[model samples]
Target: MATKKTQILILPYPIQGHINPMLQFAKRLASKSRHLILTLLLPTSHARSISSHIGSINVQPISDGADQQGQQFQTAETYLQQFQRAVPGSLDDLIRLERGHDQPQPTILIYDSFFPWALDVAHSNGLAAAPFFTQTCSVSSVYFLFKEGRLSDEMELPHGIPRLEQRDLPSFIQDKENSAHLLELLVDQFSNLDEADYVFFNTFDKLENQMVEWMARQWQVLTVGPTIPSMYLDKCVKDDRSYGLNLFKPNRESCRDWLCERRASSVIYVSFGSMAILKQEQIEEIAKCLENLQTRFIWVVRETEMAKLPSEFVEWNLSSGLGLVVTWCNQLDILAHETVGCFVTHCGWNSVLEALCLGVPMVGVPNWSDQPTNAKFVEDVWKVGVRAKEDEDGIVKSMVLEKCVRAVLEGEKGEVVRRNAGKIKRWALEAVQLGGSSDNNIAKFVTGLALKD
Candidate 1:
């Protein structure tokens, strides 16, 4: 009789944040299990980047023929259609690539929550498929709620719910027309989750005990979080890997030098995640507000120019020596820096976790999707941040932005927020230590997935 082999194929949604977590999970699996062979199904563009950062794992770039169009690739719908057409054939190709090897074929498909087609592909191929929820368990519950028709409208959530809002819904689920189709797709996809061996969430059980319990009653749910720490531990014990997975080219020197000059806990760092684009007017407003506050800041401004800024406004801080603006920066490193006091953020999950881990307070400026809910958690529940108000036009005004910045930086409440953030940071660090909830959950997840064997 032949020895049984376990092959796990990981297919992540082709975006930076999603891809990063999936890669970390793959790395963790690789470290613990020799019986498991890992194959990452990635975009052609991302293949080289991911491969460079990860260890001895096979990266198979899916060829959709759409990538040949290059710059012409416009909408999400187009990418989805192309991916749907390509993934099945790509999976077959990967299987063929594995067949001549001295190992078993892929027995499990580990996929992102957004990729519903993975379930279909895995079922057709007689393989178990596990969905990886990259966001918080709270956010995932909201998604499941929407699918169950618990929420009537998309724009604004029904008011009396103590813990959540309609804005907590995922980006694609924010529109009624779009959400109808999305909920239908999610319902179909999630209904078959029981067929999968297990589902993995990038959050610890202690962090969300209620949601984890609810999910466990439905399907096998494994909570594994702060994957970065796990990756760091792996590096420390194993190969001394300097970095995990980062797709974007970060601006490092400028921000670090700026941080070096500032006093400890004095500079504010501001960044919206990659996808949130600001209007030229909005950008100008933010610039003006930052200038008005007269505090030292490190701002990540992706776009080159803003139309509404006066000529003087553009030149206001060019040589002012108090602000450092860059297109992108090494955010994790900056957050961990001593001089960094607060974050003015778009409230993406990864950013929130990073801030919490570093004990840095924030000025929450939730742009869209689940960000408002994230803001609510930070401001209301965590007591680590303050929310900026939206004007009558529902736009966040310059004055409001300035006020929130000042509140986070200098107000009496800011001191309280700072202390709360520090406490959360201590708890976050403790959670990752031996005997801590996050540490214990990782072990449990590994054992449940049979990766420990």
Candidate 2:
């Protein structure tokens, strides 16, 4: 019999945040001294961007023949069905193709937690399939909590519970109807987790021990994050680096140059993430709030127009030259810049990690989904940021936003938060160093799977 070759293939869910950590994992595995070939499967939209970042690896785009028009699919079911149709036999086809090549066929398949179909594909082919949970371990634990019926009633309570209660629960679980559907899906999916050869979390063990212990009891779970080391290694091997999904034009250099001109620890960087849609009134509120602070600010607003703000407010900011607004900014580069003292963010996991890694304090205004939970982690557990309060109308009021921003930027509390953020940044860097928690976990994960084969 011919010797089976060792290869690893990564399939990430078709979203920006989901794709990033998986790409980091692939990059790490590719750097290993072992002779394992690595392949990354991404949406066509992500392939070009991911391709530009790494070399000597194959980026396979799954082409779902849906109309390329701007029509969006709202639910996961519809999106998965569309992709299934477009990439009908692609997974199996890829396996067969690898086997026919002079090189080895893939021995392990690592896929996003949301892509359950990859689990079935791996099982049928007798290959190890590891599920990568892209969110923090706390978020994943809360998910399993809801699955186990521990979080249902507490989630329904109106108010006055501890911040941990609200934050630990997944954001979708807050809505009764959506939570019902989400719980059902989670239960069904989690039941199959035991069959998975290994489960990978993009977090460090020191962050969420309770959840990590729970997950490990059921399946072999590894805590290998914040995934920055892998990304840094990938960058070291390349001379040219690219940013953003290849779709939008990037303004990274401009944002960095603007930061260069500002005083140290003076600029507040604001971004609502890639998918948040703020109403006109909300935009006006935030714009006015920034004006009230009179601080140097760089805000990334993705909308085509900004008619919501008062004309006077815009004029004052423009005249003072204290604020620069762009439709989109290069977030990573901006966060890493030394002059950026604070981040007013939507609390996406990737943004949270980036800010923590760079030791920048945050003012979290969570919009939707996992953001609320992520925001809670930043403020409650990490002590590196504060949460902005929403008004009676459920929108974050301008005054409250301003207060939070100023508190994080200039107040005495701001200094303490910044110091703590610096501590966390050191921890993040150490986690990815040689023989660190993240490094050991990845090595053990790969070796365990290899032995299984």
Candidate 3:
């Protein structure tokens, strides 16, 4: 007789970074157990991108009171407010309907940590709540600390957590202008995490061992990541590289072909992830740094945010072989490419883990949020990257950008950075291999998760 399918319901916070890992885990879980049925609750607009990546899995798009065409709000704050208000009803309807179905009722709801509201929804519906964190376990711990009012400038944070000044948190929480409206959301992310029956982190033991240990002290946390594509982790799965989820339609060939022509480890890969909007002066400064370096570079700039660039510099780069600026590209493919040397990134946790696993040295130009803390770890703790210094105005000047880039590529420190990145990659590969800590943790979670009889 066949076993009943474990209907696992997953709800990711509506963003590419959050969705990608949760979806990857869903795929991983499905691949590991044939006796499982997976359903994802995604924003209606994002459903296509997700379906394209993992079409075999079940996906039910939730209407966030937005257009059905996938268009999202211009700002995160407004989007979160609207999304939080719109999602509870859809969740209630789906869980209620699924529980009454002929198949086994949904066993559990794995919701992103950012949407702590998911726990309340899970509680109301009698579903087990599992909070899945897409950020670094270290960052997740820090957020929980922030929520408890346990963090202060004078207090020394625990080991493995970045010793950040109170002002160094995400811009929405620390910056006077942005934080005023969105600060509460930052706290809310961790508020409900503890109430979860199972807590998940897209990280592994040894990667952030101290943080993982500390996090488990309060709640039994499971480390089940670098929750990335199986291909990158050297799993023996075909077509596993295409996570098939991108908010932007990436032109991979153009970027891949461009990367091929560049000398090995000579290209500077620069991206600020999906959300950061750089000031015009910052953009111009970066332009000058690229021009001054005279090396091959690829920069991902959003189309709407392109106006921040100096028109003269933009036109000049169009003609110069020094840089290639596209709105978006397959970031993982680019990182894996041999020609790419150093990454200049915004230090989003996914990007941080990706760079580490790939063994690419970094020039961290952190903007806001956990980025500063991640940057500190990259430079001070991991010894795999250098953090670029910004001026008093909070913009990394052209000179600082130039120096950090050069340091990672040619300076005396480059050798050590490369060596450390190489060392970490080896450990990361080991962690994801068969019976590795990450692999075991995920397998353990799968075997133990069950539904009410």
Instruction: Point out the higher-scoring one by TM-score: 1 or 2.
Output: 2
Sort the candidates on lDDT, descending order: 3, 2, 1
Give the top-scoring candidate (lDDT).
3
lDDT of 2 by residue, 1-453 (tens): 643447788887776677767777776666653566678777664464555335545677655544454357887667766676655367767766776888777887898887667788887877788899888766766667667777654454212223365444556776758566555554455767878888898887666666677667778898888765344322432322332233456686778788899888989888887777787778888888888888899988775555555788778888999988887776777877888999999998888988887899999988877788888878877889999877656588889999898888877989889999989887877777777777788788767656766
The digit string of per-residue lDDT tens for model 3 on 1-453 reads: 667777889998888888888888888788777887888888776665455336446888877767543465777887878788878887888888888889768878999877788888888888889988787777766666767778678787877766676445655546646576556665676776667888888887888888788888888688888777878876644467867577888878999988888889999999999988888889999989998998889999989788888888888888876788899898889999999999999998889999998999999888887788788889988899998988888899999999999999996799999999999988888887888887788788887864333
Clashing pairs in 2: none
The C-alpha stretches of model 3 lying farther than 4 A from their native spots are: 48-55, 67-74, 450-453
State every prediction's TM-score relative to the real structure: 0.87, 0.88, 0.94
The best candidate in terms of TM-score = 3
Candidate 1: residue 112 Cα off by (Å): 0.5
Question: lDDT values of the candidates?
Answer: 0.71, 0.74, 0.82
Q: Give the lowest summed-lDDT range of ten residues in model 2.
A: 236-245
In angstroms, the error of model 2 at 376 is 1.3
How many backbone clashes are present in model 1?
Answer: 1
